[model samples]
Target: MYKLLIRPLLFLFDPEKVHHFTFSFLKITLRVPFISTIVSRLYQVKDKKLERNLFGLTFKNPVGLAAGFDKNAVLYNDLADFGFGFIEIGTVTPKAQAGNPKKRLFRLPKDKGIINRMGFNNKGVEAAIKQLKNNKKKVLIGGNIGKNTQTTPENYTSDYTTCFKALHPYVDYFVLNVSCPNVSSHAKLEDAAYLKELITEVQKINNQQNIQKPILLKIAPDLNTIQLDEIIDLVNQTKIEGVIASNTSVNREGLKTSTEKLDQIGNGGLSGQPIKEKSTQVIRYLAEKSNKSFPIIGVGGIHSAEDALEKLEAGADLVQIYTGFIYEGAGLVKQINKAILKA
Candidate 1:
């Protein structure tokens, strides 16, 4: 129904606008009494066998909604009804910003992929925390936090520290998001030394709190094997909880989308089918390098049960979906969860 009926209608509008409209509609629909129950009945796949614990949090399943979807905390309850094991919200910054200009999100339908330079446009950490404070659901929520674009790398630790403190009370885990390709200076923070400083600072603050939430680093899919090895070592040295194998790739190699059309869409992270193999490769590398000691949350190009299975087999403790949710709709969660159970 979504691919045939709802998606075509939604795709008719500008991608970003449609995203807002769809979430707004969901927010309204989910507010109605008993609507959540009905939605869950239609979408959720219940199985006690699917429950798994990761980073000290109990997830109903291993599939979660990746960050960048609910950048702010809005619509988490609505999304929770759709059967996701958990939801990671935000790439939120210290302050609210409009992000990049219009037409930043582009759909590459031919490639079953998307190119986005949304620049972490979010309502900021405070606003997200306000929404989260009111949230009543038990579903695990991970906060994917990033620095403001204007913040220089010299003071980057402060930006991550501020966001980490603000969201500490609300989230089940933390994903340091220094790898987004959209923001101009954001990718530069992915340097191993800088990342270690940022993660260490956040860990210091988390330790002071009564409850310490597990913190994981989110990395780009574009890194090479040596760089990945450094990251694995860094994870071991930092004692961070885990790694989100990928954020999104800047690579557009081998995309089915034409050179002319892709060139026209230029400069953003490429996600979906084009990223699946590389993401899995990163997972495999991280898994082997860590000797399977560090848990991995795999995210990139998961559009089917097979894709999810490949990541799991390659060594992912859990998997997340972003572009796949766009292409496969709500059923993707149930499908992946079922496949995991079968395995």
Candidate 2:
């Protein structure tokens, strides 16, 4: 119904507007009696075979909602009803800032992809904390945190530490993001030396707490083998739990979208199908290079069960969906889980 009906309709309006509308619609409809129950029955898959224990937390399954979609924590419970084993909230910053202006999100339907320069626009950490504290479900949540847009790399660790301290109690795991192409100078933190220092500083704070949450890095798909090797070494050195093997890609190579239209769309991280292969390649490289030394959460352009399987086969311990959920609808999650069972 989504591809043939709902998606076609939703695709007509501005992508950002439709995103908010869908959230509002779900929030309102979910309030009706038995709605959540019915949705859960239709979408949820219960199977002990799919359970996974990684980074000290157990996931009901490997499918997760990637960050950026639920930039804040508002719709995590509602989204979880759609059969996700876990949900990752935010590329949230220390301070809430209006991201890049209007039209920051673009859909490339022909390519089954999306381009977004939303710039980590989230309602800061405090707002998400309120929602996290209110969470009633036992669903596993991963917090994907980032620095404020205006913050320079020199003092960026402070932003991450602030968010880490604030959200550590609430989220099940943490993803340190420094690969977002939309944020100015964010990539500077991705340098091996800088990343090592940043991760070390965060670890120092994490050690002070009695119970330390697993910390992972959200890297870009654009990294070369040398960079991936350095990251693997850093993970081993820092003893941070894992890595989310890819954020979106800045490369526009081989897109089916028309050049004129893509050019008009301008600069942003290109996600969905265009980056699937690249993401999986990164996962494979990291897994092979490190000899599967640590866990990796795979994400990028997963639009089907096969796509998810490919990620797993390439050595991703868990997989996440952002554009896939947008293109394939919620049923895709259930479908992927069923595929995992059959596999």
Listed in order, each prediction's TM-score against the native is 0.98, 0.99
Model 1, runs deviating above 4 Å? none
Candidate-wise lDDT, in order: 0.90, 0.92
RMSD of each candidate? 1.1, 0.8
Error of 1 at 47 (Å): 1.6
| Model 1 lDDT on a 0 to 1 scale | 0.90
Clashing pairs in 2: none
lDDT of 1 by residue, 1-343 (tens): 9899988888888899989898988999898999999989988888999988887888899999999899998888789999999999998899999898878999988888999999989989999999998777758899999888788767778888999998998998998887888876765687788788788889899999999999999898999988998898898899899999898888878988899998898899889999999999999999987799889999999999999999999999999999999988999998999898898
lDDT of 2 at 267: 96
Top-lDDT candidate index: 2
Residue 17 lDDT in model 2?
98
Give lDDT tens digits, candidate 2, residues 1-343: 9999999999999999999999999989987899999999999999999999998889999999999888899999888888899999998889999999988999999999999999889999999999998887758998999999898767798999999999999999999998999988855778888888889988998999989989999999999988888898898888889999899999998988989998899999999999999999999999998999999999999999999999999999999999999999999999999999999
Error of 2 at 280 (Å): 0.8
Error of 2 at 119 (Å): 0.6
